[model samples]
Target: MASRTFSEEDLSCPVCCDIFNNPVLLDCTHSICESCLQKVWRTNRARQCPVCRKRNSRDKYPLNLVLKNLCETFQQEIGQRERYCGLHISEFKLFCKDDNQLACLMCQDTRLHKNHNFSPINVAALKLKEELKIKLQPLQKKLDTLKLKDPMMELPNI
Candidate 1:
């Protein structure tokens, strides 16, 4: 079986436009942030589904534990993509040109990277990608030659 992919919208609360925080399931089969639901109920003076406008007789709704867990895991996965400094627990936003390494703002202030030139992570990533592409051209040509020599061989795309 294959794993399913969920977009940010799938996990987001329509009221808050962000990931679900303490989500609650309504009688109408819709889910919303608990706080957001409370705010809407208070403002409108009615217990109803915000999305479908369906009136709910019950005052309390069940907490969507499964959705809450999914939202937390998704947030953690996103955080994992952005490298963080172990020492300061800050996101790496810059690349130290002299050291050829990623650095957080705290690391930039330290003496270890003193006087070293730095570039934004995006800029550094683009520069490195271009360099890698240039370096791989000859290797790619050689692989093409080999592929021609052995037509039956299935080489993985680089």
Candidate 2:
């Protein structure tokens, strides 16, 4: 058997198109946010699975604790990946030009970074990307030349 990987869509509620908040599992085996389910039920005036339209007889459904926990964990992981600073456990909002590194606001006030030039993370990222593109141009041209010299050197399309 193959293991399946879940994405944000897999953890999201069909009704809200967002991560599940207090998700509830329907008899049809579909999960939806509790608030979104309430809104749908009120508007439709029916107890049914929002995804499949399968009628549900129960007035209340049990919360999908597993799915809820998965969603929360996924969100935390994504947040940590985005801009989190491991040292300070805070978001990286600035780029330290002197040290050429990302830094949280707390790092800015530290003695080590005092008087160091800083830029917004997004601005610094764009500048770095542009610089990288300029640097890679020559390398890319060389690779293209090599490919032309040897047909066997051609890379497969992803």
Best by lDDT: 1
List model 2 lDDT by residue over 13-106, tens digit each.
9988999999998999899988998898997767878889999878788999999989888877776676777778788999999999999999
Error of 2 at 40 (Å): 0.6
| TM-score, every prediction | 0.54, 0.53
- Clash pairs, candidate 1, are none
Clashes of each: 0, 0
User: Candidate 2 local accuracy as lDDT?
Assistant: 0.88
Clashing pairs in 2: none
lDDT of each: 0.89, 0.88
Give the alpha carbon lDDT tens digit for every residue of 46-119 in model 1.
67687898898888899999999999988887778568777787889999999999999999999999999999
